[model samples]
Target: MKKRTVADRGADGSERPRHCADGMPNTTMEVHVMHKSIRTPHADTRRRAAGGELIGSQEANGTHAWRGIRYAQAPTGPLRWRAPQPASAWDGVFHALAHGPMAPQYAGLLAPVPAKLYGRIVGDEDCLSLNIFAPAWASDAVPAGVQRRPVMVWIHGGGNAVGTAASYDAARNYAAHDGMVVVTVNYRLGVLGWFRHPALHEADSGTAEERSGNFGTLDLIAALRWVRDNIAAFGGDPGCVTIFGESAGGQNVLTLLASPLAAGLFQRAIAQSPVAETFSVHEATERNDLPLESQRTSAREVVARLWTAAGKAPDVDAADQALHATPATDLATWLRSLKPEELLSVFKPGSVGICLSPRPVRDGVVLPLDPLPEVFRHGAWNRVPVIIGSNRDEYRTFLADKPEHVRLLFGKLPLLRDRAEYITESNFYSQAWRSLHVEEPADAMLAGGHADVWTYRFDWDEAPAVPFVRPDILLGAAHGMEMAFAFRDTAGELDIFGINTSSNRAGRRAVAQAMGDAWTSFARVGVPRLSGDAQWQRRTHGMAAETLLIDSPAGGGLRMAGVRQDIASLKASLRLSPQVSSGESRCRIYARVFLWSPLFAGLGSEQEYAELGREFGCAQPASVFRQLTEV
Candidate 1:
């Protein structure tokens, strides 16, 4: 095998070295397209003439690129809540010049703001799209043995509400420098994608699949299916695909790993700050306003009272019926009204009593079983390799947004500016402890196969860009900060999730260099290497798991300095009495239900069911039985 640079062409035909009349090099380049058009069934799409590139294939100059490709169709209008269907082929060449739109944004989740104001576009309905960057010259002519490359698919994170694949540009940075292909994908977000109603099943009763309501999630499945079927055309090994994402995206990745629908679509997976827990079907029905025995009851009630003045339960299938006629705008307003309360309703409700509690639902058709339970009981995609970890200050970001909420809890505010103090003042000490429980799912997934599990914490925080005290208040590498370095867009301004150090060129380069190498190496093979030459250690059982910490000093290998036993204790206490509050109840139920279902199935442990009982405020045996049977 011959070593290649980003610009070099090997067996793949090379483009002619051309210059303008004035002999100036071209700043813009054309990306190649792979067609599944019936007219060109076995078509060859070499971009030698225009520099079209395929994903995951190595090229000369060590640069690789894959332009626009279809992962899933936009699920708008009649398609809303429907499973994604394969996209149709085109006749003339289609240019994947820019990213497609993001999912519809509501008040919470992925609500996109102005790019100028926030550096990100708000969510839209037409967000289904795909983009890839690979070695610039990877071509069909590249021999088969030399073309064996690992593939990485990225799912953007925005709390499962906001964010798009278009938010980041991996083409110029990670793909070019790492010598591997990178793919970014978009999926449905917020109510437009996740809303559920019982009418879905009866309206389309011929198909049992019509009942489940995880549209955004199924969009991911469609994307993976596209990669499995079409990635090979771009010199990618369909068998070597890896799915990775952050936050909600991370949650989605793990959900797919556990979902049977996603089995065998990819060989490895990574989830950052994963939302490992989801609502049981019963919980979803309750939150979505469905009656304990019927979704139609609640949906009809809302439609009749809210949408129709007559307040009548018209036929469910009637297009103008109250149940089906509720507008998307109205739905978004309803969801937004519930946003602020989510913090209290779901995770860490402090003073507030009740809050909005919309979460992922475990419908038997889509989710099958709860992810945590599935993982704990050795029930997910057992054969794939995985890398799972969380940011150092995952929850503090939430704190930064609501200082008053903290003041409401702790009485007087603590004057803390240093990263350490902030972590303490923000109640991070308690939060981080409970968070360690997240490792159960990853551990179970790795235990069943030849899996390499790597964990990490990002500690770097750039100097504050604006006029704010604690210029570097230092959330200590808060959630999603690592994304800037990973995608190598530290210099480029983005719509939202802006560049961390927008002005510092050298620091961005170094971090980007390190991150790109690590990610691409993992995609190429199974292990991730931090730098071009540095060897990353594979994680093993019964050892202090080595984590590559991205901090002021760019280095790998760091462990949590503080003890996590406090969190364990807190978790245990919460399990015994989850109904103390909504946040406590939600977190405790999520942890126990997810923990037992995945790794210790049929354990019938008292702690697990006891936690569930507490979540529903089941004061008596009859109430507990009622809740379980109703679900």
Candidate 2:
């Protein structure tokens, strides 16, 4: 290993440490000079590059934490809505002392009555920054190689609108335990990133032609490029990299899979609940109803309307200046000055609102076409192994907020919600009904694979006791619930999954260990394998295969029952039925009966159950149930 000296910057940028890769300077010694007062670039100690700074402890892990490294120049003035440009390199060792500001915030869709109270404050225009957390240079945690440790690039999620990489705390997973270099990045969000214009596309012309949209995704690619070139200095292996995320980040991973620019960047990917959708530039442009100029025209009109409403001359430059100089509080107050309906009419219209006007542009270059079609075609990605699945009650979070609202839609029968709610509530009565029941639709989505999809239901419902909300009563493994388990993380005053009891804790730990192992192992090799003979089976596209359920005990025994067969029959019937879309198919009709039939069977209402099945459109003989016995 090359010897190095490091030092801490003392306010006016002066080095402080004496000499210590090891305390003893003779035997196997190397000194990391904390800071060199000289302010010389390479003359300070070790490797030199562009503007960079050291962080973390050299003595502890030989890892230097480089905070807020700029990947792109500030997208302001003329550069706004234009493609990102590489940041200009600096001469001396510039200080990367603080995290760069996040992208300028916007009042998002449905941004409450009191606007400031609705969402987070907007940040700076120069928000294209990244944070690196790696093992310090002198630590024993460094991977055994001439190259540095592997890198894991994490992209945070906020519906492609409201999240930041800074929100995630890596104290437990990436920074402390994994021992790999972890990079969390920030990019433009909402309109700032996804805005488009015909003039902007025309500006690029034939030579330096650029896509008019998907700038946020391009930012991710830029960050990966930075990692490929510079990670070696921080003892990170550039070759072995894994890109992982959830929600929009998951969507971003799917986007990366389809992006030709991101072709050779990542070795493997894990997409958790990737949303399948199609976005188009034409569709995006239509949202604003821009008269050929897109957002610029829209912005101009909005400024005119706002100024006129405020009884001032509708001066565009003055409005722009006001927007720039005004405090966040003032912006909210100014916005509130207008009537809600008046503001909505001018800025937002019907469902196609201003806030989501120009979303991730589907320009031909950066985003060639609809990504979903490419993914469904399967050849678009490099065919690298992928791990994809959703939580058990994936749709539960969607319904959790409004029980009355949910009842309006789901309570009307010939649906799965009522039955799912019943089965979920059945757990309170006894463990008997809760034993090994699988929801039909979830099973169908898992089984109908175009790739090697590993399915899991995060059933570790160990939440805190709030009034009216019971873990068993409401939110049975809701959407996004698995994120906590996958990261094995906790949030809020209490751990988000307040799994208090020893049994619950043990279950959480076991599931966490299983998931963490699956993730890291998949990153290392292409396939994720379990420790024992407990193989992580690949769910095929056609047949209903077994899924590894991460329940109480880590490697608990498999389900002895035949729930998959029942699900398979239901799926097959739906595809064959003529009444499929009408919500009255035999499959749908039988599904409800299947959930409650066993209950009636015990009460000698077996004949009544059979007659009910006839009413529900079960075309087959119902008496075959009495002939079969449990193994």
Candidate 3:
């Protein structure tokens, strides 16, 4: 099988870990407690919302914070792999302070997300919770006919396998400063988030939704439902909500955009660096390797491999056998009984150091057949306004350690920031790799409706990137770097999510100001402003694409250039070129072939010099090209 080049990080190459550790018995009861502190608010008796009473905390800044409030029933014990159930209302005041435990971490579970490249997150199964950041005046009680500020629900990125709502705090910046209600969420991770089994069908109540393998996605939907029902008290307008996220979280937002289950949950969305990969149930589940094996793909078979490697967690290992040999009844029982840690080591990285276990399944019931095809093919449930974009350099760090051929295309050796050495990724340059990301969807959304979509390329490259140590390799705005600017407040300057930036960049603060205004503005109204001065044009297809190239120079001053190029038409032309009859005129071939050619990215300004008629040694079988086109 051919290897895939880009995803959210290779797990961003979407969102893994696998395998037993020596000596320790990794199991359920023995599950480790996450240590990240989720602060409970100082006691506030007067104001409380539905879901019983929530004890709130008052920040020094006068912002009200409510952390670690459950939004769904725990997916533990018999509830494992089931669709999330609404959180049972609590009796006493639910202490809204400390963050709840995040979903367990494993190769199957990913964390530090795309933007969160550093930080230790403690994992737990009881992790479906949300934190609320509301202004002092925004109480849960709102008079009928009165309206509150718009709401923004944040989803954190970790390759899809691992990340926690506790990983970020948007209260001080987004809510307190912007005067909007902010909600950060914690969803299931790794296998707990996405998994499917044929035998699992009999376990459900026969409801299509019950047997779904999209728990993480369901968790997000549930949070939105909670926001819609209860946000007014928090001083938020439930009818006007925007969902935004970076990396895997961004991909989730995109998923919500295409999901029938998520229709009407939010009126607007912003997806930053969304991983463009999706999986089918069989593709997600099927694998054959190791001590206990099935010839083909099966959830039980996948689990049995974990059992054999980890020596059981004792539940399923206690069973007679795995694979086809295990009875359906026994399999279901074994599945429910398997410990969290027991399942932890079942996944590991391949020879090239990429973990492959965590991904959402496209079960026709909950998730559509394919997100890209469905939304691009006019299959969206809510035609909401979308702000979608990618950074100028998305996959540099991932390429830092890959083979030479891989590096040649995606890498900028040491310091050479601009002018990438060669087009290594079949095309060349990491930014070029991301062009398809924003291009495909933005064009589709525009074709669907005007002003319904906006696309951008994040170009802020001033920060440290280690930055003092190695600015050269960091190149132009790398993946997940724009997040701090987008979610932060201007006063503090420093951000909670640790990304490297310094005052040295002349107008760094200006960059943050631009992003903050854009994000908060979009949340308040449908339209977003990249900078105070620049006008953001809606992206459209065939028509010259007006992409807002957001960049701030060394001295300062937000440079928002509305570059015009018909990326949609260019991509469309590339898709059509291979079909033209052979022996065609050079002008026709020159027009399409060279642009998409593996050499295009490396060509730089020499595009006019490149000749398509010349025989190039590097060419895939014609059938492969056609197959890829079909896909």
**Highest lDDT: which candidate?**
3
Q: What lDDT does the true structure give each of the candidates?
A: 0.50, 0.49, 0.60
* TM per prediction: 0.66, 0.63, 0.74
Best of the candidates, TM-score: 3
TM-score, candidate number 3: 0.74
lDDT of 3 by residue, 510-586 (tens): 67767878877777656786645577777755545466666665523444344433334444343344433342222
- Candidate 2 lDDT by residue in tens digits, 330-356: 453444344323333333221111232
Clashes of 1: 47
Task: Please give the ranking of all candidate structures by TM-score, highest first, separated by commas.
Answer: 3, 1, 2
Model 1 RMSD in angstroms? 11.8
How many steric overlaps are in each model, in order? 47, 25, 40
lDDT of 2: 0.49
Where is the poorest 10-residue window by lDDT in model 3?
Answer: 16-25
lDDT, model 2, position 188: 73
lDDT of 3 at 44: 44
Cα lDDT for residue 24, model 1?
A: 16
